[model samples]
Target: MNLSVNVQEEQGTAVVYLAGEVDVYTAPALKETLLPLTEQSSTTVIVNLSDVTYIDSTGLGIFIGALKSSGKAGSKLKITGANVRVKRLFTITGLNEVLDIEEDQREEV
Candidate 1:
């Protein structure tokens, strides 16, 4: 599946909404969008993955890089809206404690 990223300015944070699969082919796009945001001040980056279908190691690595980059500049990068399967991946990889991840809960229809 194709990856789609939509970026919006939320309060003082830059929120990136992601959908579809994030793998080797699509990681660059995300990187391009995030790296620049990490370089600045006065804003944090919040990556919202509610609609993301899948994410490979490369994608995870990109997040790590963003975290580091933002940290160097005294900013923060956060993640939210991850499903159980994705949350499991983060836990198994020991990134659950390292990264700020928010569980996604949807209202029943």
Candidate 2:
């Protein structure tokens, strides 16, 4: 599937659910969706990646930039529900220790 993003609110947090491939061709769109949230003070952004089929190095670069941007703005970005492949990428890049990467227990509604 082509990359798509769905924005929603869960409790007081802003959640962005991503589906399909996130590659050199699609990372820019994800960056746009996240840019505003990154500037918000005390914001908590949740990136739900359960439906994401693939992601390349460029996509990972975007996530890393967002993580740093959010931190500087006093905001937080958590990556949740990444599949085995994506999770392995995080571990391989040593981002698991720097970013809030977690397996989500909540089912999609």
lDDT of 2 by residue, 19-69 (tens): 999999999999999878777878899999988978999999989889889
lDDT of 1 by residue, 1-83 (tens): 79999999867799999999889999999999998988777678899999987899999899889888887887778899887
lDDT, candidate 2, at 103: 75
Q: Which regions of candidate 2 fall more than 4 Å away from where they truly are? A: 10-12, 104-109
Clashing pairs in 1: none
Q: Give the Cα-based TM-score of candidate 2 against the true structure.
A: 0.90
How displaced is residue 95 in candidate 2, in Å? 0.5
Per-model lDDT: 0.86, 0.87
Number of backbone collisions per candidate, in order?
0, 0
Quote model 1's TM-score: 0.91
- Find the candidate with the highest lDDT and give its number: 2
